[model samples]
Target: MTLHCLPSTDITELPATVSNSTENPETQTTAPAEKSAWKTLSGLLPFMAPYRGRVILAGSALLVAAAATLTIPTAFRFLIDRGFSLPANVATDASASATAMADSGIAAGQVNSVFLGLFAVALILALATALRYYCVSWLGDRITADLRQAVYSQVLRQDPVFFETLRTGEVQSRLSSDTTLIQSLIGSSISLGLRNSLLFVGALGLMIWTSPHLASIIVGLLVLVVVPIMVFGRRVRKLSKDSQDKLADTGALANETLNAMSTVQSYVRENMESDRYSQATNAAFDSAIRRNRNRSYLTALAITLIFGIIVFVLWLGAQAVIDGRMSPGLLTQFMLYAALVAGSTGALAEVLGDVQRAAGATERLLELLHAQPAIASGKQSLVASSTADVAGLGARVDFNNVNFSYPSRPGEQALEELSFTIEPGQTVALVGPSGAGKTTVLQLLLRFYDPRSGSISLDNSAIDSLKLNELREAIGFVSQDSVVFSDDVYANLRYGKPDATDEEVRQAASDAQALDFIERLPDGFNTYLGEKGVRLSGGQRQRLSIARALLKNPPLLLLDEATSALDAESERKVQMALERAMSGRTTLVIAHRLATIVNADRILVMDEGRIIESGNHQELLAGNGLYAKLASMQFNAAEFHPAVEAVRVANSPC
Candidate 1:
C-alpha cells in the first residue's frame, strides 16, 4: 500500500529548520530558524517563472470572474428596489387602471431585463472561471513536470556517497509524494485562495458601502478569527512536515524490504518483515491522523468564529431595517455581501492550511534540487585512442601512494598508501581474502571514489583531470553481483552502446558465451528479463553483463569475480571466451578462485587494504608467500570441479 500526500493544518508557530543530507556538500547545512513558510514556498517561483504569461492570463480571468460575481448582488439590489416599487395607486381608476397596467407591464419588462443582466453576469463568471481553471491547471501540470524532471536529473548526477546517507526509498518519496503536494498547491489551492481572497475584499467593500457601521464590526470580528487560525496554521505546517517524513520512512522501509525480497523470503522472515512494515505504516498513519486532527480543530474553530460574526452582523442589519435606517433592498444586498465575505473567509482558512503543507513539501524538494554532489566532473576529456593503439599499447594505469576511506566510515581506511601500475595490454589479477581492498582498487581506477592522498594517472594524464564520463567510458566493468535491467535482451545489450547495431550485440553476446542461452529463451534477443534479471540464471546474468562490457569494448576491462557464478563447464567455456577477449586489452581481474587467474602476466596478492605480494603465477608460487598458500589451498581443495581443474592444470606447470 502507498502513502498519499495529505493536506495538513496548523497550530502554534515553530521555527522551520531543515537539514540537508551529508553527501551533498553545498546543501549539507541547516536552514536558518527565522525563515517563514511563505519564504520557503518562494523557492517554487523559478519553476513557475517560465509560465508567466499563463499566470497573468489566469489571474486576469480570476479578476474578471470575481468582479462579475460581485456585480450580481448590485443587480439584485436594483431588481428589488426598481422592479417592485411603483407609482402610488395608479391601478385604482379605469383609465388610470389601464395606465397602471401599462406601467406594470413596463415594470415586468424591467424585471425581465434585470434577470437577463444577471444571467449575462453569471455567464461571464462561468467563462472566466473556466479560463482561469484551464490556465492554472496547465501551469500546474507543466511546472510539476519540470520540477520532477529537474529533481530526477539532479538525483542521477549524485555519486555513491550521496546514496550512502539518502536511501533510495526516501528519494522516491520526495519525488512522488512531495511533488504531489506542490502540484495540489499550484493547481487547486493557490487559485482558490486568490479567488476567495478577491471575493472577500470585494464583498467586504460592498458591505461597508451598504452599512459602514455593520461592516466595521464584521472587519473587527474577522481579525479575531484570522489571528488564531494563523497561529494554528504555523503548527500545522510543522506537523505536516513531520507527517511527510514519517510517510517517507515507511516508503524507505518497504523499498528496502522489497528490493531484498529473496533474502527475506530465504530466511523465512515474511511475517517478521510484514510486522516491521506494519509498524512503519502505523507510525505514518498516526502522524497523518495527528496532523489531520489539528486541521479539523482549526477548521471547526474557523467555521464557528466566521459564521458567528456573520450571524451577529445579520442581526444588526435586521435592526437597521426595522428602524427604517436601511431599505429592504439595501439590507438584502448587504446580507448577500456578508454571506460572500463569510464563505470566502472560510475557504481562505483551508487554503492557508494547504499553503503551509506545500511549504513543507517545497522545502524538502528544494533541499534535493539544490544539492551539489561532492564528486563533480572535470573539464578535460580523455582523448579517444585507436583500437589498434589500445591493443598495442593500451591505457597505462598508475596509482601512487593513494589513501582513502569511505565517507560513511571516515575513521577506518578502505585503502592505505598503496601503489600499483599496469602496462599497456597487460592482464593483472588480484587474488586475496574478502575485504583485502581488491574491489577497492577497481573502484579507485573507475574514479567512483577519489583517493585521499596521491594521484592516479591514465596514459600520463591524471584521472582526476579527465572528465568522469570520459574516464569511466574508457573502461569496461563487470562486478561479482551482475546488474541486469528489466528489459529485453537486445535492449540490455544496447544499453552498453545506445547506437549499437543488432549484429554487434549478437557478436558481443557470442564472445561472452551468452548467445546460446539468449537464443533458447522464449523470444530470443527480445525476451523480457524480469526485474534485476531475475528471469535469468546467475550464470546467465553474468554472461549478459559480460556481453554488455564486451559491447562497450573499452581500452581497459576490470572483472571482479566475473566467472564466480558459472558452473564448472560454463566456467571453462567462459574462461576461454575471456581469454580471447583479454588478448588485446588491458585487464584487471579480482578473483578468489586461483584457477581463474592462473595465467595472468602478474598477480597482486592483497591483505588488509595493502598489496603484500606481486609477481607472475610461477614467480609468486616460488616466492612461497600469500599467493603460494592460496594457490595450494585451492588446487588441493575439492572446491575445484573437474573442468576447472583442467583449466588450472593446463595453465600451470609445477
Candidate 2:
C-alpha cells in the first residue's frame, strides 16, 4: 500500500472540463466526445503507478493461477485415456472390467498418480487465486484512498471562484460514489479481465493445435461476436456516464434538503422535497436501467455466439472421435478447452462493461483533481514589518481604485472604485444597506476574489505578490453567519489557533463573553457543539466565532455584523472586549447598527458599491447623508436620549 499525493498545481487555471460540468452538469456530465471511454481510464495510471510492485505481484499470481487452470484439462486427458480406458468390451461388469484391466496390464498406481496430479493442479490454482485476490484488493483500497485524499486536497485549495460553479453535493458525490466505481474496476474487474484473457488465449492456442480446422472456424465466429460487443459497449458507456450524473443529481438534492432541514420544515415543504428527491432518484434509476439493459444485450449476444461456437466445435470433435480421426481423450481435452475459451471470452465481455463504467468515474475524478483556481498566489510571503511587530499593529491594508464583480454576476459590480486605507492600529467602520458592498470590501481585503481592475496591497506590498497563507494569516475574519464545526467547545475555539495554549483559549472565550455558557454546558469546554453548533443559541455561536478569531490574534481584524446575533448586554460586553483588542490593531468593522461604530476612529458610508461619505459618527449625522438616514431610522429623536445612548435597529437592513 504505497502512498502518493497529487502533482502540485498552481491552483489558478480553472480546468475547462470542470468549468463545463459545474456550469451545466446535465449536458456536460460526459467526458469530451473525442476521448473514448477506455482511454479515460488511463488518467488513473498516475494513481496506480506508485503501487506497481503490488501490481506486478498480482499479475504474476494471476498468470500462475491461469496456467494452473489450463493444465487441468491436460491432466484429465491422461486420467481418462490411460487410467479409465480399461478394455471397452469388458467394462459393463465390474468383475469383467477388473479382469480386462489385469489382462491389459494396466496399473492402479498410474491411475492414482494421474488423480494426484490433477489434485495438485487444483491446489496450486486455489493458492494462486487467493494471493492474486489479496494483492489486487489491497491495491484497490490503497490507491482509492490516495486518490480521494488528493482530490479533496485539491478542492480545499481552490478559491471561491472555483466553487461558484460547483456544488458541494456534486463534489461529495465524486468523492464517494465515483471513487467506489474506480475501486471496483481495480480490485475485481481488471484482475478478472487479465486472468480470463490469459485463459482465452491459452485455450484458443491449444484448440488450434488440436484441430486447426475447427479453431479457424471458431476464430472467425469470435470475431463476429466481438463486433457487436464493441458496438453495444459504446452505448453502454454513454448510458453509464449518464447514470452516474443522474445519481449525482439525487445526492446533490438530498444533501441540499437535509442541510436546510430547518428551512424546509418551517415552510412545511417536506412532501415537496420528498417529491423532488423521488423524481431525482427515479431519473437515476431510469438511467441505470438503460445502461444495464444495453449491457445485458451485449452479454446475451456474447454468451450466445461464444457458446454456439463451443457447441459446434464439440460436435465436430465428437464426430472425429467416432471416426477414429482423434482419440476419445483428445476429443475430451478439446471440449474442455473449448468451454474455457467460451467462458473466458464471455467474462472478458462482462469486464469490458465494468471498465467502461469505471472510465466515466475516472474522468470525473480527474476533472476535479486537475482543476485550478483563477486566483494565483505568489511565492513571496508577507514580511514582518517593524510597526506590525508591535504585537497587534503591524498590518496595513490598501485598496487603490479597485473595481470588482463576482464571477457569477459579471454584469453587476460588487465593488466600484473602492479605495480605502486602514492604517496600522486604526479602527474603521463600513456602514451601508444590504448589497451596498460592505461585506465585499472585507472579501476583497481578504483576497477572496481579485478586483476586476486596480490593486490591493497589504503592508505596502501587492496582495497578489504574497502567498495566500501568509496574507490570510495576518488578518482575522468573523463573518455574519458564524460557522462552528461539530466538535468540542475547546476545539472549536482553538480552530483559528491550532497551537493555542489552554489558557489562551479560555481567555479568548472569556473576552468574547462565551466562557459562562461554555462552563454551563454538560461537559464544559469539552461539550460537543453538534453540527454547525446547533447545540448553542445564535448569539452563543457568534461568540464562539469571535473567540476563534480572537484566539488567532492577527494584526488586522475584520468583523461583519459580528454582534448582530447577540443580546444587548452580551453585545456591550463583547464590544468592549473588541474595542480593547482593537486598541493596538488595524480593525475594519462592517456594521448595520450605527451605534456600534459611533466611537470608531473613522466611518465610511457606502451605497451602490462606492463610498458616499467618510467621517466619524457625529460628522456623518451632520452630513445628513446615507449614514445619517440610517441612523435616524434606527434611532428616534423623541425616544432617543443622546446621553443614555440607547438605539434600535432592524435585524437585517434593507
**Which whole-number lDDT from 0 to 100 does residue 29 have in model 1?**
29
lDDT of 2 by residue, 1-654 (tens): 111011111111111111011226432323455488768888888988988999999999888888888887787787777767876567578788777777777677767877788788878887888888899999999999999999999999888877766778888878988888888788877887788888889989998987898889899888887788889998888787778877877777888899999999999999999999899778777877888788888888888888888898789888888898988888888888888887777777778888778887888889888888777887776764424645556478888999999987989988899898878888999998899999988888788888899998888888888888888888899999999999999899889999999999999999988899999999999999899999999999999999999999888899999998987788888888898778778899999777788889999998989998999887787788888788877776533533225433222233
User: Which 10-residue window in model 2 sums to the lowest lDDT?
Assistant: 2-11
**For each candidate, C-alpha RMSD in Å?**
5.0, 6.9
Model 1's alpha-carbon lDDT is: 0.81
The model with the greatest TM-score is 2
- Candidate 1 per-residue lDDT, tens place, 1-654, comes to 001011122232222222111223332324546468889989899999988999999999989988988887777787666665456656565687556656665545666778888888878887888888888888878998999999999989887787776877778878887787788788877988888889889999999998899999999988887788988988888778777776766777788899998899999999999998898778767877888888877778888898899898899889988898987789889988887887777777777878888888888788789887887777775775333344565677888998988887889888888899998889999988888889988988887788899888888788888888988988999999999999999999988888999999999999999999999999999999999999999999999999999999888899999998998878888889998888778899998888788789999988888889999988888899998888778777844577447756765667
Number of clashing residue pairs, candidate 2: 2
Which residue pairs clash in candidate 2?
A: 12-373, 388-394
Error of 1 at 242 (Å): 1.5
